[model samples]
Target: MKKIAIGFGVLTGFLAFTAVAFAQTYTPLAPLPIGEGGTTPDTYTLSSYLVGAIKLLVAAGGAIAVLMLIIRGTQYVAAGINPSAKSDAKERIMGALIGLTLVLTSYLILNSIDPRLVEFNLTLPPVGQSPAAAATPVAPTPSAPAPVLNNGGTNPSAQPVAPAAAAPVTITSPTTAVTPLQNIINARINRSNDYSVISNCMGNTTYDLCVKTDLNGDGQTNLSDIVLFTQKGNLFDVNQNRVIELANTTAAASCFFKMPGANVHAMLPRENWNQSWSDGGSSAWYISGYSCGGSGGITGMPTVACSGATWIKAPALMNKCAITNGYMNMPFGFVYGGGSQFSKFQNWVTSSSVGSAVDLRTLFKATFFRPIASGDGIPQDEYFETDDGKLTYATIAEYDLNNDGTADFNASGADMTAFSACQGGSASGACARADFNQDGTIDARDLNLVKLMRNDVFGGSGFTPLGWILNWFESAFFDPAGYSDTQIISYCIGHAAFERCGYADVNGDHKIDNADLTAFNTGAPLLDFNSDGKVDLR
Candidate 1:
């Protein structure tokens, strides 16, 4: 009975121990906040769990070591008289201590090597809910070509070329608002007035001598056309009288020095060549009988023929006079009344006195006055008459009276005087010379034209005849001409007269103000002050 009770008690105690051990619920640490997208914990989460587990394991090992020491002490006390029992208890205690030491040492060593080693997590998010599996991957951006750094480094692949700089702005202004001074000057200077004398004498016997000085082609010898011979000189018809408009009747009635008919008998001795004869026939004539020693009869004083007698007409007389005097005859009728009577002309004939004349063809290789084509907005009459029956009645103005290529405006006293003289005259009188616009009268319009042309000429607006010619030459023979606002501004600032003369009158309304400045800024070539190929206020 005692043995049964003891066994039953032991069994009961074992059962109770087993029940207690099994009943103590192992509460697994509440899973850390679920990873993003409910996936398994990340390395950090797992590492944290491992650290907790190691701490728990160390506590458990320490508790087991303490329980073992207590049990070993009890066993040693119960076996106080037995050396083997004490020795066995001590051994068991030592084994428990060694096992605990080993477990702790292993944990320490593993933690020292890598704390994450103990962070073992068996928990995982449900299938199909992994954060990494649901994440959207990102694409990398394309890289630009690296700049070529000239340091001592390996060369890189070629890069794309850079774009070019922006082009200059092309500014434009209103043409209608601006006075067309360039066109006006071009028209005036390049008149096609066919002076028949130039055409007739071109191939004549006198051509060799005639072309030397007979430039303006009026069948006369004068200073204006002398440049035709020199080719490098300037010719300015300041008086505006080189070309004249004549009535047909007046042209026909005009008389010049002439030789008498071959049928006429000589009234005076041929030897008395210097003698004078006055004829009452409303005309002037030279003594025809004198052979004063030249190919043509000697030039003599005017003679009055006896009644029904023969008198030399003027045209033939001029030819004879030219031959005798060793000069070319003025194509205009001979001057009868003043100290000009029998004034010997020097530049007319091919006399040894003057140099040999150049051929007209060679001298005029380029026509200075190319007629603007018709329908170009300019009046047909703007050009001088051509031999093809095109009669242009426009008169060139004496705007630049000083003949300095630039219109001097108030600086030119001569221009002022002439303007005053013809300021109020009709088209038939002296005012005709100042009739710049050719409206058949010298009025405000004519003065205005002069003023416009003067401004253009001095302001370097390229409206003067010479300016137009040069521009035309450049465009025709070289590269096309280009003008800029800089050039116009440079001219305006360089010339003081331009400033005073209202150079800013870009729009011909005749006011100098902000509008002009705006026009200039917007690329008015006329505003360029010094022509330095740039546009700036300075």
Candidate 2:
């Protein structure tokens, strides 16, 4: 027994000596690579020194743990006769293994929690000064929808569509009644094929499968066009399989084959075969890999799922209409001067017959406006506690009915009624009380109606005009400022009942009171974060 113990001690000493020698000679703990270009950190820096120290400590700890594990494992093997000794050795081995694992994986555990945890920046700011400002967080840009492409065909990104037919067919009536598929067919058939410039060929210009191929002239060329195309059973054979099967009904293929005046044959560097597209009465060029429909096996178009906000055309009178949502000054500002004001989801069709009714609520939801962090940006006076015990921006400001510096009193029922009447263009006795304090014209008055209500008049409304509001009325006909009394009054004429004209009934509850006040008094005006010519809110 004594000999065995002495032998074990010798072996342990030898192993420890070997580990130390190996570490000193090789220094296995290499400097960590850092930064974007994977360059090693400066050795003189405190962070680098600390990292080096940590790496050394971890390597030493791991070595010690492994050594202990080996010692215990040897003990367990040697103590074959004594069951109690073997069990104790086994437990010690397990403990050593666990310690080694922890030592080696400490960085990984910290990183898994958060990469910042393992990172350190010990550099201090200069004396009597704060640290340099961090980079500003940019709001994420929304991705455009992907194009629906056909199967068994290469993308015609650079290639032009086939040339015009030998006898170009001229569309007689632009408003002719035809199937949606025929609409696409007719437009493509009529477009003059320009090889050098593909502008005249208006088949899926953006190729997002949204509206460039508006064959029915509905302004929106979506799944409905493809559904109608498939329904008509006159789809262009994109895949030259000599058959227009259900498999060939890909959105990409549908638009690709029928591109007006596209020299598809010349552009494609492959073995070409001549195929013909017969749209009942006409024959056009169908390139290789496309096939005309066979007599059978044509089912219907597959059900496709598309997600986006539904836009409806509001009356042109709703242009540059500002609405107060109680909390912020003119938060729900809808500038519908034309479709050009919208950042996304613009009207595709310009027809007077198709009344585009835009969904204002959905449009605002997707927008990234001035977002306020909890208990930040808002003024102390503007803060109010909600019924749910949560503090938020005040919904309503103290109404100074008579445009005084100080708030007159809590807004009353008569005050709200008078304001509503004034909004309705009531020029008579009591309604005159609701009149805003103006120097001369309504243009000179505050653009922010809430500011006018609170009597918190500033030279400028403090709102930096964003895209939509800036160009709302920059047209040749209307006033450049877009704040003429005539324009504002004309806007208020029909929209007094609606919230569009900045009526005090912000919550749309009919009667304005304390609850309505809860939506007033945000310290700042509305924001247009993306500069997309529209006011947005998170």
| Highest lDDT scorer | 1
Clashes of each: 35, 38
C-alpha lDDT of all candidate models, in order: 0.34, 0.32
TM-score, structure 1 vs. true: 0.17
> Per-residue lDDT tens digits of candidate 1, residues 1-538?
3433464476458435433331221324455543433444533343344445456667886798789889998998999889999999988877777766766776787654333344343334345655332222222222543355678452233233333474433332222121232232223321132232222233232233334334455766543443352221111110122321111111001011122222222321122222343585343333445442233342222134321212222122112211112222222222334322111111111111112221221111111123446542322212122211110001111343323222223534555566666766776554443544333445454454334324442233543232121112111211101222223322222112222223324444454344544444453222122233321221
Candidate 2 lDDT for residue 169? 30
Give candidate 1 misplaced runs (Cα > 4 Å): 1-51, 121-137, 140-538
Off by over 4 Å in 2: 1-43, 133-538
Worst 10 residues of 2 by lDDT: 251-260
By TM-score, the best candidate is 2
lDDT tens per residue, model 2, 416-477: 43354456464346443333322122221322434322332222233322333211211111
